[model samples]
Target: MAKAITQIRRVDPTPEELQAQSITKIIGALAENGESIIKMLDIVSQLDQTGILDALDAILKKRVDVAEIMIQQMNQPTMHKIMKNGMNIFKFLGSLNPEQIRMLMDGVGHGIDKATARESDDKKTSLWSLGKAMKKPEVKESLTMMVSILEGMGESLQREKDHVH
Candidate 1:
């Protein structure tokens, strides 16, 4: 019976004992957080007392719950992590020996140059080449303007592509 009572006493925290333990923990925690908590409390008190809270309330009241797809798209941490991991893999690949990388590059590049050469050669023989080659003033002016716009668009596209990834 005394053993059961002792066990109960050992297991149970009395109100005073629990309170004392809680106060000790609080003191330890506060000691660790003393400076930061004081600053945070001061800042929060100022914000609440000095009408910043009112301004925040007004701002929130004005906001409609319109879900922005673009904002959500920008904040995709998973996609960021995936991209980061992929880039890390690429970097790990890049750190590999030059001979192996060169072999891989050579294997992948085998027909690529020929394919690109063929495509560019096809575009070289333009339909307008005959008309534009004649250099008629009207054709020349129109072609010049078209080429200028194409150049501008190409520059803009290249710039955008450069900035991306």
Candidate 2:
């Protein structure tokens, strides 16, 4: 006859053993994150001492009511118009090229500097001086650009009207 080996049975932990194991795991975690837990506890203690925690709780409790009131206000016509105008302004800005925007800003700054210099001089330009300035290539180019922009604006307005109708 051949000898046979018996299979071993597994044992479940007792309630006391389970509780001790849980405590051990908790202690291990606390040891690993001791500093972080202390900081969190300090913050919570400060919040409680200052009554900020109660105020925050109160705010959170009435969040739905606050949201409803905000919604009601935002639904008004003036709010709608304000939001629409803000969105349109953003869309307009978004449509502009970055390089062109930079150029426009630079031009505005240069114009401001020129105006300040002119103010400090306090000298009035004669008709002859104005005529001579107008003949400059830079002035001519600027006037041409202005005229083109006005023409483009007129065309765009006409298209918008046609679309609306």
* 76: Cα error in model 2, Å: 1.1
Q: Which regions of candidate 2 deviate over 4 angstroms? A: 1-62
- Candidate whose lDDT is highest: 2
Error of 2 at 136 (Å): 1.8
TM-score of 2: 0.61
Q: Can you write out model 2's per-residue Cα lDDT over 20-77, one digit (the tens) per residue?
A: 9999999999999999999999999999999999999997999999889999999999
Worst 10 residues of 1 by lDDT: 1-10
Q: Check candidate 2 and list the clashing pairs.
A: none
Model 2 score (lDDT): 0.94
Query: What lDDT does each candidate get?
Result: 0.79, 0.94
Best by TM-score: 2
